[model samples]
Target chain A: MREVILKTTQLSKRYGNFTALDNADMTVYRGDIYGLIGRNGAGKTTVMKIVTGLTEQSSGEYEIFGKTGKAAENEKRKIGCLIENPAFFGNLTAYQNLRYYCYQKGITDLKQIEEALKLVQLSDVGNKKFRKFSLGMKQRLGIAFAVMDNPDLIILDEPINGLDPIGISELRDTFRRLNAERGITIVISSHILSELYAVATRFLIIDNGKVLKEVTKQELDLECSRCIVLKTNDTKRAATLIENKLNISDYKVIDSGEIRIYDESAKPDEIGRTLIQNDVTVSGIFESGVSLEDYFKQLVGEAQS
Target chain B: MINIIRSDFYRIFRGIAVYIAIGIMLLAIGVSIYMIQPGYIGNASVGDINNENFKTSNYDEVMSEYTLDELRAMSLSDYRQVMLKVTGYELDRDILGTNINLYYVFIFAAALAVTVDFSGSSIKNTLTSAISRRKYFLSKLIFVNLMCLIFLFANTYIMYFANIIFNTKQFSSDISEITKITVMQIPPVLALAAVLTGIAFITRKTAVFNTVAIPLIMVFQLILNIVAAALSVQEEYLHYELQLMLAKLANNPTESYMINAYLICGGIIVLFYTAGWLSFRKAEIK
Candidate 1:
């Protein structure tokens, strides 16, 4: 079994009458670039906060490096987090802010600060005050802070929020490098599914404070693979024809007029001919792959239903 | 814990607010020294002069009996004596009164120090580190007390040097007595700092803490005085108020009032610190 860097078992969080997170279970393994996918107010941040000790779970427990209760504090020191907005002293420069935290963390080697800034490509602007930094720079600085201590686990919530395309790509490369070279387990959440899809090895889909599904890169790739989309007047008949006639069981009837065939070997021409032969009026037939966004939507749709 | 304290001190010194507070304090001291001229002293002594029945007619006769040179020498000696009584270290009991308003500055400093972590959301970073909540709370408590003590000593020395420069008279109290008086004033200030810091941490907003804490301190002092009056405690023994206790301690350092002052202020510090720490430990950072 891979070393589990962090695990939450039936975790729940409630604020007053509102249940922010409900019976959520999550697992992040060492060296895994885990992507957390959710819509706004989907309890993504709540989970990250609980893991980082910014907030407490209402029920259940989470273990860091297989430690629970007070012992987890020591485990937390190995985790770096940037939940929500990156918080720092606006009056201090990026270097100063990082230095202050370094002091707090008792990191005497100042070289780490320089290296972190350099990694974020912020070495040139290290002396610029945080208040004067652009939104993109601030986000980069936040990432730098998270990765500065060379933490075993880095938990980032929407770390790419304000980055430009180039900045995002740079950060993506940085994330990949950290996970590949340094063996850092990264848990990142972002609405930009394309970017997340590029780096995440595993995906956790959550909706309404509950974990909808957990998918590995292989599973997600299979789900997002090129598939024949069949639109017929009778999707039930089309689905049956694709399954019985084409011997393709990996198919779903999305609606009365739509059927999605996930069989990579099933040809669109054959699928359309089979639907026609089955006396179903074929409207549209084409091959397409699911985007991460579409996959997330489907997961949430399933959870809601 | 040491790292937290060191970081807090670094942040405090780097920020502009602490310097602003210190500047305001020094300015207040400078203005007070400049305002305490001979004319004001003479006016202040008028009531005492009348109470003593030292008629103005006697001054005219004395002036006539002495030559101009003799009169000048005599007037200089009298001026020195009055200045000694008014501005000497022994006269420093009123130092607290002249600088009591500076308590607001100290309150601002304490509030800023405690609330910076929340205002900037830096506490999240600190909490996520290896430090525990208990250590953070203890570090803040130590930081506040250390700052209060430093300010107390700074104010005491400023008043001492100001007196020496302006009055040009020998101090009635020795350095040891003056040091004791200054040291006795610290407990109440530390108690006040504790309460303000507690309010800052509990509210986690400097504006709210200031708005609530300043009026709270004033009203608390008022209520204590009202209760003391209702109980018909002798005015001399009514060191229940912090200012009163500080003044009484400064004037009579060896008195029982000093012990009572320390006990009451020390108790307040403990209560506020405990509440602050508990609230901080449980506070959920967003």
Candidate 2:
């Protein structure tokens, strides 16, 4: 079984009468890029802030690495977060700023700073002051800080907000590299669906301080289609049987041997049985849900409605 | 806590503000000592005090007996006493070195070290992964007290040696006496630093912290003096306030006065530190 890196059950945060987070539940596993997808003020950043111990929860509880309370707080040292915008001393250079963080984090070896700078492609401009950096550069610096300590889990809120296309692509590669090579669990939040879609293995859709849905990448891919997509050895035979036996004519043969049956009433088990009885090899059969954007919008809109 | 202090040191040394503040402090010291040098009155240094009209009838008769050379040859402290008798100017060299102005330095140091972090959002990074709120607040208090004490003692000694070098032996206090005065002043100055630390934690914004800190002592003094005068309070009771006590304690305070100062200063330190920690412990790092 995959290691549960972080889990929150009914975690909440309230400011006065308005709740910033309302009984939110989230779970992350080791090596998983958990994307928190929500619009602005939807408690996406609030969860990240709370988990990192930058702020306290009003109620509920959370654990890091199976530890709770003070133990869980101690576990926070293994997690790095960049909440909201990149917070740094503007007057100090990138190297100097990281040095300040290094001291705070109690990092003794100075080489980690260099390694982080190189990982974010900021090694060359380490001497450049933070105030003079471009927005993209600032975002890169934030990512560098998150990964600097070689944390077991890194939480980034809107990590791709200010990046250019090339920068975003490079950052995706960095995220994948960190997870793939070092077994780091990444929890990143963003309002932009496509950006999270590019790197996240699992996603949690939140709206109005509530979690709408949670789905994995494969499940999300399935949810992107609106029909039962069936792959078989014999497409002609399968199509004939689907049309004649099921009387499903609103279907299209998408590929060489794959067919998309758009009928909502179409059952895959019956179709697979019929196709197998008719000498057609049923390789795969599943209901295709919808496009990623439409699926995300549907979830959020459904939650609100 | 050590790590936080180290990081603060790194940040402070890199910034130009600390250096500028120190320079201003030294300049203020020089000008202050220069103002109390006895030879200088306002902008011009009066070569002969005998030439000035003695407004007081009693000291005027006394001054009429001494020649200009004899008056000029008098020891600096004795001359100052004669000047005090004749001109009614209170000129005690030790008391003139520093007053409540040192509190401004303490406030600035506390603001730069503590308030700037919150205002710049840098405290989020520190508190998130590094240390607990308790340690953060404790480190700030310790560092501010240490830093302000350095400035305070620097003023005391620099004034001591500076007075001797410039104004000659007559105006100077004994080194041991100067040390006694400096030792007695620590509690009150530390209490002042503690108050600033508390303010920094509460305000949590550089602009707001400075706005409160800069005029705080003066405003506090004004309010107290106004209340005291309105009530027709006795002069000795005015010294009960730490701000006034700091100024008066340099003039060879009695044992009772020392005991009173220690009590008041200790209370201030406790009150402000408790308030500061209470504000910081549950404070959200926004």
Candidate 3:
């Protein structure tokens, strides 16, 4: 088994009468580009903040590299993060800002600063003050800071928010390269599912401060596989019929009285006919595949209901 | 912790505010030196030859009643010194020697040093680094105090240079005495800077710090004066108060009084620094 880089057990956070996170549990393993998926106010940033030590969890325990409480400071040193907007001194140049952190981290070699700048494609604009940089440049510089320390794990919250398409693509490549070449575990949260789909090795779906599901990329891919979706009065019976009569057991019963048959060889018309013959009231039947976005929405919708 | 301190120093020196503050302080010192003149005349009896305007006042006033002939007979340096004393430069000892504007300069420096982290949201980066919160807060406190000391020394140097350039008759006090008085001023000035730093950390806005700290210092001085007056405290004991200690150090340098000022100012620095650190450690970075 790969080592678990980060784990939180029943983490919770509250603000006065308002509860921001409720019994949230999450896990990230070594060398996994973990994607955190959630809508607005879904406790995504809260989780990242708590992990990065930016915010305190009201009640619960988190372990970084199996170290809990204060001992995690050492573990935290091996982790880097860019939570929310990238914070930097507007008066200092990009190189100066990164150099400041480098000194803080005790990395005396100036070459690392140059390397980080080059990695983020900020070498050319290293002398420009942060206040003068555009939003995209700021975001890229933030990435440079995160990766500069060569941390074992990098947690980014909406890291690509203001990037243009080209910038986003380049950052995606950067993430993939870091993960693959350095064997670094990455925890990233973004609303752009398709972009996330391109890089994430695993997905954690959250809603209302609760973890709805955690699935690996292979499992999610299988979940999103081409399949025939059938809405019937009784999905359990429909599933049984499809398994018994059609000799197909690869199917899942989703919420809203729907069954998705993953048997690629089985046609939707044949499945529909078989359901009807088995006295199953087939209200709707269609051939479709779930995108990550659709799957996230469905999971959240089910949790709400 | 050392690395964090180094980083803070880098950020501080690279920024223009600190340099600007130092420049303003130097300019203020230059202006004060150019404006001040020594008290030249000793206690001389002018009762026999004074005009009617001299009748209402004493010996100090008798010198002010000099006739045109007497004024013309006086040397240029003596004339300038008398004029300076008459214009209340005697009470302006603090302004001329101790760099009176340093109090405000410290206020500005402390606020700029601390609040820039907040306004830029750069504290998040620092806190998230390998350094602990305690170390970060300690570094800031040390940085503010160190900057205050540097400004104090700079002001003192300028004052010495000004004295050498303008006071051709030589200063009444020796270099060692001047150094002792200058050193005594540090504790109170540092204590004040620490308090302002605490306020800046709590408010995290330069404007807010200025608005709150200025009035608060004035009110504190007022309250101290009222209490001193009510208690019928001796003029010497009043030097033990916060702002008065600095002023007293400038006007009246005494070993016993310096000891008391040190004790009080040292206590205040400790109290304010502890409070500031606690608040900073507990504060939620948004």
Candidate 4:
């Protein structure tokens, strides 16, 4: 529904014999919180770097805001990014560091410097050198630098890598505010699928430098079909009864006592009655939906298979 | 380009390694001055021990026959020759007071600046900006040479003041000749800096790169100087051939036949730089 701000077609990056990214086709739409999810060394950073022009691709092409080559410079102005671990001059103050970055980006507004610091919640760092800032604070500063220009699109790579729970929660809230209020499209890469699930509107799952699939938030929501989690004295008996009576065999006993049934069409009451008749004493029964972590694991398993 | 240059300048100015090396150079120069200034005696002998009179004629004969350690036990004349050879030709107060030593400081700057950029992820970020590779390389070359020029002028000015303080009478030695010498020195110094920058970019690191480059550069200059000398070129021109040609052409350094040397050497530098950029542009920054 939203306009596409960035796109890549068969973009590939090769390091000698090894292909770090292979035919990665990705589209980042405007006003969409696009999550790039993958494991370590999954070519997430490579894709980010290539798209940002920090690196070159061996084959294929990428268009930024309908621009290519030197014209990409103009399109780059609309996108802000923090790819990989952000490095700063250790001796410079946080403010000084941001000022240097802004100067490089050709932004002249000193007022935005303050706003950047405030946006990252690093205002209280106050004259502290970059070396002294905590890892979380440094990560925040990187985010601040990325969004300082109020870019239309923001790309962050593991922006919450070093943050604590509270810091991460705060950053999550900040991202929400930025998306909801400013309508800035964000493309963030992270290995933390659960954290991504809370904020991402769309997802691109990558492994071995290839995009396996791209799914929307509504599709992802539909993925979490309602199911029953049963804790019974005998999981074997529960499984047998469900299979024979309800024609269900696709279920897994999480531990020794509980079993999760994946069929959405089966009624919970019918399953309860069948289990009782089969003499499988279910001590507890609760209906819940699948989580992002579960869906991610399934996707990963499917890809591997 | 300005931003990158400013960042490079800040890094160089703030580097402890740079200042430490500067301090060491100044200390060495001070020691040299203390050792040889007029009547100063470094050891049992007067500063006259290292004069050219003892070094060239007699020292060569003695050194060719006797091993180095054997000279330590020889007669005073032999010992004087040995010491003189080790100490090198007398410090020409005319040239010495010119702060010619500070020219090496630019060499140090060029090496450090280029080496540091190649050390980590810095170069990737620097070149990735919306600037031509040529402009990026040129800006660095310009800033480094300018810094070297400033240091050269400042150090020479101070050394001249020192000569005045020491009451050396060489300041008035053919003002035209002194100016020729001073102006002639700039080309070689600038050339050395440019060559080193190119070498650093090619090698891309200090430890192994310098190990290989330093010897190659020294050997190249020595061989080139010998060739130039054999061809009856002036000593100044020979040195210029080795050091200043690239920088001279880049900055339009001189108006003489030296400009020809500059153009030739500068062309080589451009060629090397183009190669370096192409290599770098294709380099995988993992």
CA lDDT of A13 in candidate 4? 89
Tell me the native contact fraction for each prediction.
0.73, 0.70, 0.67, 0.15
Candidate 2: Cα lDDT at A206: 92
The segments of candidate 3 whose C-alpha lies over 4 angstroms from its true place after superposition are: A229-259, A268-288, B37-63, B66-100, B226-237, B251-256
| TM per candidate | 0.83, 0.82, 0.85, 0.72
Q: Residue A238 lDDT in model 1?
A: 70
Cα lDDT for residue B206, model 4? 64
DockQ ranking, high to low: 1, 3, 2, 4
Better of 1 and 4 by DockQ: 1
lDDT of 2 by residue, B54-86 (tens): 232355566777898988788756665554444
Error of 2 at A205 (Å): 0.7
Q: Model 4: how large is the Cα RMSD against the reference?
A: 9.5
Candidate whose DockQ is highest: 1
lDDT of each: 0.77, 0.79, 0.77, 0.67
| lDDT for position B78 in model 2 | 67
Q: Write the per-residue lDDT of candidate 3 for residues B1-286, one digit (tens) a residue.
A: 6787678788878888878888877777555455443221111111111122223335357365888789879875576666555423231244423343576778767776688778777777766665677777777787778878888887776666665566532332455655766776777888888788888877876678778876776677677668878999886565466655565676555678777778888888888877778777767677
Worst 10 residues of 2 chain A by lDDT: A218-227
Task: Flag clash pairs in model 1.
Answer: none
Instruction: Give one digit per residue, the lDDT tens place, for model 1 in B1-286.
Output: 8888888787778778888878877776655444332121111222232222223124334335557676356554463443333323333334543334556677756775678778878788888776787888888778877887777778777766776676443332355766777776778888878888777778887777878877775677667667777998776555456655555555545556667778889899888887888788777996
Candidate 3 lDDT (Cα, 0 to 1)? 0.77
Residue A218 alpha-carbon offset, candidate 4, angstroms: 2.1
Best-to-worst order by TM-score is 3, 1, 2, 4
Q: Write the per-residue lDDT of candidate 4 for residues A1-305, one digit (tens) a residue.
A: 65778899999989889999999998888888999999999989988888877778999888887787778865776777777766666667778877766666667888998998898888888778777878998889888877887888888999999999999899999898888998889999899998998889999999988888888987677566666888898988788888887898767776789888878777778888788887889788888786777777778788889
